[model samples]
Target: MQLNAREETPVVSVWMITYNHEKFIRQSIESVLMQKTNFPIELVIGEDCSTDGTRKIIEELEQKYPQVIKPVYHKSNVGAARNAYEFCLPKLKGKYVACLEGDDYWMDPFKLQKQVDFLEANPDYILSFHDCKVVDRDNKVLKEGRLAENFKKDLPQESIILGSLIPTNTVLFRNRVITCPKEIFSVTNNDTFLFALLGQHGKAKFSNDVQPSAYRVHDGGIWSSIDNLEKRKSGLNTYEQLYKVIDSKYKHLIKKALFTRRLMLIKQNKSVLDSIKYYINSYNYFYFGNGMYKTWLKSHYDLLKQLYRN
Candidate 1:
């Protein structure tokens, strides 16, 4: 039976999660509104009680595009994860949910059409995402392409668990991909954890045809609130916590990935003693064949250097 794309129902829902994004809310909303698709699409904005004028802008847009723009306005500032699991996820009425942060915008007008078509054509794939350009606060292109080189390749569930391979703003996933499990509430890196869960259900792909979206990297970002070192450390902890809740097969993969991340973080450290301390804590979760010996020696040398300096 040949499936007709035009005959497909309007079941694609775009979820926009925002908090105090007055600066970029308009552009984000406009981008969603600009999508050209044959099927009907609804935009659900999860406004997390913005102190800035972001809520006002959303209210105005909702009034103008009442049929297209549906917003869940919170009274207080709940964190992004809660706002998503509690407020946003429940309101989703579409068969597939596409996510775009309030600060990010789609570069291509056919973004939604392309992604929805892919999902309809490829039923095995649980999630379909594309490359995204990283931009700064001023909308200047900081990175012309995707953040990771491997992002363009077709990615499996394991790859998603090992690292963040999918660009958030460019993702269009099945509505059933997420269940809002309580265990993930504490995860600092929600995207990676959620992606892992989604991956378990089916495969994920980085669509080559879909137009790229613009992902803003700025100080105001939730992840940007902490430094790189802290974020990585927090991510490692999140992965460990996830290991307990996830299936056994994914447990080793998370630890192995965190082990590699710990190595990178260790190299970034200036003090040898600090590196040794980091490794000592890391030993509880990971083991690398001969690399472990080398790290041990380097850590000892650093400890010696600290002793000598004193």
Candidate 2:
């Protein structure tokens, strides 16, 4: 679809990436359209050649909201990371940018306005994000309240490295606070990496008072669909890569995360060799010395029980 030029530049660009989101894309797009902001905002969608009818739906939306919706239809299915890095992010023409996946929708109409207002008032902060609700495919609220309930008003880069504290759909960050790093694409969880990268430029704020958005958990969700063990594995992989690329100050935090993941893997792993390997990897962190013997004994005991049962 050809992008319709606007008489005025958009104040915020909503970066959305979709692939096979035919079921939820409409709601996702509409939520952005419903946003009430005094400043102009554009929804820039990267439709990555969805095998389903996602592209068709986007086409219809583009036709209706020509001025507000700008979509780049990929000829082939480039994965989400590539779609965002190659197509979607580059097209953003706003002073601030927000993220929304095709499967998730915003709940609050003033979400963007509140975030932008806070950022404008507080120049020290580079990014602002709020809490969101977790819902099932049918929009049943599985969990209510903040995604990161324990998060401080001022976010630390260490907290981000430890876990995903910010919901992707609830984020509003400065457009060019830092140049998009190519290394982020190397990790499966690019959003987490991007947030960590952005955290370095300045402070990050958690808008706890703002209304929560909706985060959908479905079989089609890239991260949510996976089992707990696989999710931890993916997180471990992301942390490993992040540890190598991020600033030296953050390396310890990543290592601490790696240790925790390895310990968790030791408990979840069924294979004796894999469990032992995780135990060995856990030694890289300083905290490994604390109660590590208990973990080692427990892993061996579990393996012995499995062997006896067999």
| lDDT scores in order | 0.79, 0.81
Per residue, candidate 1 scores C-alpha lDDT tens digits across 140-224 of 9988887567557777777776766678888999998446778678788888878887777778877888777899988898775
Model 2, span 1-310: residue lDDT tens: 1233554788899999999999999999999988888888889899999999999999998888889889989998888888998777888999999999999999888889999999999888888888888898889999996554456366765565566577888999998733466766777778877877777666788887678899998988878767888877888888777777778887777777787678778768778678778877777763654555676566567656655655
lDDT of 2 at 84: 91
Candidate 2: Cα lDDT at 268: 83
TM-score of model 2 relative to the true fold?
0.86
RMSD, each candidate, Å?
4.1, 3.6
Which candidate achieves the best lDDT against the true structure?
2
What is candidate 1's local distance difference test score? 0.79
Tally clashing residue pairs in candidate 1: 0
Q: List the residue pairs that clash in candidate 1.
A: none
Model 1, residue 139: distance off in Å is 2.5
